[model samples]
Target chain A: MASTLHDTPERNIPVQRISTTTPMSGVTSHPGLAAWSLGYREWLRFVRQRNRVIGAIGQPVIFWVFLSAGLQESFTAAGTSDVQFLEYFFPGTMMLIVLFTAIFTTISVIEDRREGFMQSVLVAPIPRFSLVAGKLAGGASLAMAQAVVFLALGLIWGMPFPALGLLAGMAFLLICAVALTGLGFILAWRMDSVQGFHAVMSVFLIPMWLLSGAFFPASNPWLAWVMAVNPMTYLMAGFRWLLYLGSEERIAAGTPGLAVSLLVSFAFCAVMFWASCRIAQARVRGDVRS
Target chain B: MRPSPAIVISNISFAYSARQALANLSLDVASGEIFALLGPNGSGKSTLFRLLATLIPLQQGEIDILSISVRTHAVEVRKRLGVVFQSPSVDAKLRVWENIRHQGWLYGLSGRELTTRGQELLAQLGLADRAHDSVETLSGGLRRRLELAKGMLHCPSILLMDEPSTGLDPAARYDFWTYLRQLRDEHGVTVLLTTHLLEEADHADRVAILSEGQIVACGAPEELRKEVGQESIVVHPIPDHAKQLAAGIAQRLNVQTRTIEDEIHVTADDATATIASLLEQFGPMVSELRLGKPTLEDVFVARTGHRFWNRPADGDSLDAKGRANRKGVRNG
Candidate 1:
């Protein structure tokens, strides 16, 4: 049991280069490299954990299919004549896919801290911004990738989205992904349990998405005001407007213009990312509760 | 001039919200030495370990690692320190080499150098063959060895480990210590570890016994035990009469006696002589008697005047409440 590596005759041990006089000095930290490493780790974990992929993509596709089928006959937008409920709900379903992936990816923050992996990352020489950036980038990449798959499915179903519209829709999806993942990071950083995060998702995230005109338009005058104030409303509008870029298709009524929606969505992404970095700065202050 | 110590903790104190975790504790660890912090649960050794690892911020006082201040220069201090936590830090989803490779990126190591260093450390820690295996598939001992490889990947001058032997079996523990000693003797890397097991501390070059957020004793294991007494005598008196028997023995032998649970412990200079007189006087009362050379437990009792595992009154567990009350009375 006490057999030594030095005494193992079968193995050729490398010359022990544990330098004593000259300390290992080439170990310099770069923000970009640090960000890439952390982000890459998230992708590696996501690839290994197959259930997360199924959970993120499967639940939303089920929601889109059933909801569209049930509402197809009765539901109609006030201004649009030919648009069916299935077509009307396509953008929201894509948003749902993005939302689910963000939730799945950012929950790893709490798990890492609990399992002691975050302690090592927090103590690393890299800046806190790198930590925040890497996580958000990885999560956003995952969300955008899943959302694109849903978009392709819609195209194959004869939704007839123009090529220019699809390209513009991808840009909007990336913005929404970054913003949502950043929001998830901010929420997950303070939470100690995944159960708490689930509560937040149900009570806060789901309602916020519902009121953003993703599920249905805010037809009531006061409901319109609430949707106008929601950050997700701008994202939903930007996505809807871009999905009909080169075509004469009438999008859902009452959405803000493309310029205003893009401006507000970009602003929302900046704010969420800023808040995430601020909370991550807590690592330096020792406020990051173990 | 003599080189400064590798780690200098000066008058540091910390609190977790309302509870005081560490008091004005101070200690200096010399270069290339194996120092152990020996304490039981709630002894604040974990708090100290966190502070030195730069995981938690300093509340008061200062800690310097190789002349770099931990409070003001944490990133610098982190660069020179290799920290191994009590819980496993490796990602179970990733292969062993993948875990090391990712860790290497955090420290800015890459390509051939990172691969070479990772291979060297894996071979040295006896995990060369397991490099491609997923961490979740490895046994506890093997997982711990992988953790060591990750910590040493950056070629840190000082290794700070918290309870490195907590879940390991005896054979694995011996192998772990063998690796630690080899690190110190051959590479001149300073090793500071925390443990509750007395045998673990016995293997260290120096041991600091902590109790209730304070250092009770600090010295070599042999010196600490010798300071308590030359020999230890444990006398098991008749059931439910330990207090009375302890008082009788203390007065009869003109020595101090402590009754812990059902046993009365007496540290004597001549245990054979004391046992002879004790049997002649109280053979009918004594159920059993055992003699042994003074151990670290004796030294702990001598300095702290209580058992090592005695928790403070506000500790989380309910089982230690009775002992806590007794300890409070002694302190009061």
Candidate 2:
């Protein structure tokens, strides 16, 4: 791997750092409770501000209403999928919300680098991944919270809820949340400016949002194949699968998509987790700069 | 020194793109001494500081902090290094106590120990009274203090401040320097800071002046002053008349003439002759003139080709305050 731009090749390299060989896991060096406190503090920082709290929950709720209304006519004209636009998209929008939330949370890394918060974290006697993975897990936890509120929104919208699978659906949602945030964290590591970061993430975010059945039910054979390749499609499929558990015919029809999407998303998370660690290590070796 | 250099750097060299930032720069902060890296902008002081704090990896040198290699043993290195960046880091919505506690958690502290240490650090930083207060409400100086406390919450071996005095008012700047002295006298924390203020170096056991991405000079403050000392004269001739005026003054005084900040600055053992010559010959065309002892700017100009604050080259990432972010990979 080429060292980052910060690494001046000809000079005596500092301690050679072999970074990111495996999926960089876990940032909390102090056990579960300690990690919670760290993450909880991060949560409290954003939550105590009532506007931020409302903003977090309100975004997806509003997206559901507006996008559902916009796509209602399309659903009526569609083939025998046997689902309303609102029902089909509830899970997709929830996934999109988690995806966006992860992006927003990860942007904090750029902000922290500007303010010196990152310097404070790096100086602490902890694992290097604490700087990123801790942020990832913390963002995931918050995404999970937002996901629950969104699912509750789905319940109120008259979508057929498979009562027994709600917990399982939530479990899958948390996994998606972790996976999304992990990728966001890795992207955050490479960008130094907010404007540049948002510009690049929007490229990924818009394409993924469009392809993952968030606004449309992803039915075109050619397009569905492409959507099948998008990792987020699995999250939507998994949520839909769980939501339709007691129903007949349409239940788990997308199981292969579900299995494939989830595996791909996990793979993305693994790759990103390792990428973040590599970037962090490169920074430590003076090869990369924030 | 009781706190021995919790950090040691030797022959550190860094660059931004094709330009070098730290050219064979080296320094040591005896544990507990408030070492200050002094220079004007583009002096590579921030790059040196970031390297010592482990913000940037040593590209062409070696750094050992409390016996831990910053490269291979970064985890151990981080355990001892604490950084207070030039910009704000604490989230505005987080309470002061919460920010401090979060830093402790990153260091693997928890429960009572985290809380107690957080409290103690807040108290030590004079932020105890505002522990529950939201960080956004704090003033610039207080926020910086909170940043310092947050950095030190882990009881780091070396505490670093990169232009920590930038945003403070005059009173706060003075008090801030005093508090640094107390950090050593009371807590025995090794301190290394970067500053643009000349008087700021008065407190340093030693000071290094960096310019154009190189350590141009380094020594005790008084020694540096004495070496670069002697009378200095600066002349501002009527629009675009510097060359004519410099030639006139140099010929009379038989000394070196330099142009800095659009003015003809002449330095010699005795500037009396130079000033007299300028007043006699060039004074007719001169618009402004001043004579004084060689300040840090003189010390810098005596070595580097420009004034201390004169930015000759873009060297690092710049914050809103004009401080560099020390991104040696590709700086300004």
Candidate 3:
């Protein structure tokens, strides 16, 4: 190899380690302006993290197939739901899709820190807010997209959907996605290890789904009292009210008020977003005491 | 530009909670020169490098990197500087070319300009052939070379590299430095890097000899050696009582003595007769002897009463690397 390299010395650079000098090619062809571009790049990287978003599609698919099929015999046997059980479950599965996407997005924080990308972000000349907003937007937008796909899947599963119902469902799901992603960031910032995040997820996420009004209506006397206070109940109930019940579902559930649910989600996400920003700032300041 | 200092840290003190890491540490790196911060594992070199990089905030003192105040204008200062951390920074999921291009974009590159410059950089780093390959599949040396490539992608004027040669083969270290020197000479990139290897420091433009949390001496590598003002004398004392014998040598010879691991070191004497006479006088108490010049290692030993490798094992300091490798040979 050295002999060939030495024979063609004039054609090729010398066979020696060389620093990038005299404008090496194949970089971003020009100089960069600022650090907002890092946020964009970070968001691009998040989108390519496939496994995290797959559940957003997969979970809703399973719910549409299994839960809807399981309910046919029950609906026939009890005459419980007037509409098809599959259509009744569509709003619930949409909520589940958001839950899966946003929750898994939290784990990205752990991965970034472990992979050293978090350190890279902290060291750049970007504003702290951009880092927080960028990651949140990246995760939330992807979750919203996955949720949209799930909604389209729900449409194909023999579900009746008015145009207004469909648009309202889409808007509600996006808000839920943005809010849940904020919560995930908070959890990820507080927990350093993947195993720890896993523990929190198993203990917190599936149980929250089981108890909240996603699959079953929270009307079993004592359960209704608990569901009234559950923020996720409000979120799911809002989805139900938007997708199937026209404008009367909130009055029936008594607590899944769209206005109240959106307010609560806004406050929850805002607080979590602020917490993520604080944690990042502390890390940049090198106060890793926590 | 005048040949004033490129960096200055004045009265800097820092700690990790209760553990005091840097105690009023100070140093200067001249413009247009390579300054090596040499110390054993726990000598506080990493902390000092972090302060200069503006990766962490300054708590107690003033720091200036390239005439800009690190605290007052850290972001602006960052624009003038670059850093290659000890840990790898490339995204393993991204291909080699995208990784570089993404970093360039973050700094402001875009459009056809990004494409043209990105190609030129990959070729310059000789990573063009592997441009489409995933970063995880590349060899450690190649990944490290990519990092060095990434650091220079933004064309920052000053660069800080933490253990740039760690885990690299000997030949790779040589190649890495060759490009580094080329960058400095051609593009005037002022470079400050940390290395425990004394031989590596021998080739630096200047060296800062750190022991514990403070810099004991700072100058050109040769100048630091000359500061000791005499050839080094290494002695392995008699029996297991090397401690007592070392004390006696320090007392009688009026020179400093540091028992670094198994060896006892003494300097500041042209002492063929002194050793012969001392061997004759002490007879059975002296076991072995060696002689050398006042290199950075010698300067560190002279000021802190221990060699760089032993600087952290002294119990109060937490130099992580020194503590881990104190039992091995100093150079390793």
Candidate 4:
């Protein structure tokens, strides 16, 4: 189909004569262009695919509404009386949006590898880190966009979205998005099939989300210990605190402090980003696992 | 002083697990030549193409492109080379212009320069009218042309393509070659491609025939054909009698003969004389006979003593005699 963007009436644009005589070493050497182009292409593809945009934002909203409605009467926390199930599930649903968007965006890596695009990119002159960074940045941006939409739903659910708290929440969500997308990139880079990738998400990602105190509070000592060590738990706590910022009643529920949440989320982002770059560099050096 | 060759691959070997894909393969492609790596399936031409394109690592030797070493100077080598893989590499969701634009950015071209270059390549490849169309909607031939345009977007001095005609129809293949020749003649870009089609290889300035991970023949098409013989005489004996007739012909005429399917092939300097005598000797036993000028296919058979088209299927066990013959062929 003809693209709506470039379908303007044809004009006689003078064709500039490209000089092929430039020495190989003297060609323009802007390495960052590769990363920008890759990120931009991903953004373009994501926006054009209407179903992807819908599913990333729609599925989580549906999940949050249905799951909270089903569990609202039976759910209770030991430390708080004012926190309802829907209010408690809000941040988790935002996280779910981030997770789905991240997973959906990074899944293209496997398809790219299969369709020969990855091979072409790999053989290009740009540094390997640029490719990894581009994918992580692209996936993270999409994840954050969807997360912001889910976050806006907090107002309709009667949770106050204070300005500073919303800013902090946005920053926190961005960090989480980058970390989750980078993690997905690492997994997708090594996987040969999307089916194998889905199996991994089911076995690893869903459990990580469940244990992050999203569905239930970490009140028991053993479950608290697990949540204390879970990186996502800190993100969930940070998100909840941001959502219920001005209310002391919800704050008394004892989510982790803001500083600790930001620190752990940043650390997780840095670690995942580094790991993704390492995997991409290994592939560049011909250590492809597949 | 002679100009340096465009590509020089020396003594490179590669294997997947224990099965060797390429072994001690060495060849030189002169600058501005249209070179073809010719082979049947699993003959390692594709593997060799990957090695030259730097898609795979060199295990045993060196490949130099325009005097730059592929192993040590891979980034520089990549800068000078453009590669078109056999599979479709264009993103289906992106427009043709966007596909080339992204490829240009990979080589550090951007802004006005990238846009103008993309337009120029689209014009050169006869895709200017469809530049805004989504790649998924294009035919296989147009997609392939878009791939070529993408590969050449950075103005690479040397272009490497793996089976560039794999999915193209006959007319499309002809058009593709026309563009390739234009690239070489007008811009002096060296073109290297791998193909199993004998006619495709015949169109190249030079052809390197690979068999069992080794080169069995390398030369211009006419030269390789001349080396095989001036003419090839194929005799069709009745069914179930080819092997006996081949053996009889070898014994009676003392010429090298090989049985392929239900026919016996004998290469001769004068096909008329050979056919006349064979018919006189065998008479009614000969079902049919044909004489034709030696083709690249004949050159392959002459060099490898096996038909190019009917390679034994993978995992088929070789009898002891076939094994020994293959070993002798390899050693010799």
Best by lDDT: 1
Proportion of true inter-chain contacts also present in candidate 3: 0.22
lDDT for each residue of candidate 1 in B1-332, tens digit (9 for 90 to 100): 32469999999999988989899999999889999998877898988998998888899999999889998988988888888988878888999999999899998888888888888888777788888999999988788888888888888889999889866665677677777887888877899999877656878999999988999999889999888787778787877878888888889987778877676888777778888888878777888777666666667777887776564354432223212211110100
DockQ for model 1 equals 0.36
Q: Is candidate 2 or candidate 4 better by lDDT?
A: 4
Please give the distance, in angstroms, between residue A201's alpha carbon in candidate 2 and its true position after superposition.
5.3
A163-261: candidate 2 lDDT, tens digit per residue? 777877778777778778777777777577889878877788768877776667555588879877776776666666655555634542333444665
Q: Could you tell me which 10 consecutive residues in candidate 3 chain B have the lowest summed lDDT?
A: B323-332
Cα lDDT tens digits for candidate 4, B1-332 = 32468899999998987989888989999999899999878899887877777777788989999999999988888888899988878999999888998898888988887787788778766789999999988988789989998888888899999889867755566667767877887778899999877767888999999999999999899999888787777777876778888888888877778777766789766667777778778756777776666777778877888777674453321211122211111000
Better of 1 and 3 by DockQ: 1
Report the TM-score of candidate 4, chain A only: 0.85
DockQ of each: 0.36, 0.20, 0.26, 0.29
lDDT of 3 by residue, A52-101 (tens): 44655875788678887988556421223355556656677777777777
**What range of 10 consecutive residues in model 4 chain B has the weakest lDDT sum?**
B323-332
Candidate 3 lDDT score relative to the true structure = 0.68
Full ranking by TM-score: 1, 4, 3, 2
Runs of candidate 4 with Cα error greater than 4 angstroms are: A1-26, A76-78, A242-249, A252-254, A284-290, B1-3, B311-332
Where does candidate 2 stray beyond 4 Å? A1-38, A49-52, A66-82, A114-116, A156-158, A193-203, A214-218, A246-248, A252-272, A279-290, B1-6, B229-293, B311-332
> For model 1, what is the error of residue B174's alpha carbon versus the real structure, in angstroms, after optimal superposition?
1.3
List, residue by residue over A140-210, the lDDT tens digit for candidate 4: 88888777777767676676567777787788788888899998998888788899999999998888899
Candidate 3 lDDT for residue B96: 91
- CAPRI-wise, candidate 3 is acceptable
Per residue, candidate 3 scores C-alpha lDDT tens digits across B135-214 of: 98999888887888777776777889888876665566666666777766776667899877766676678888777788
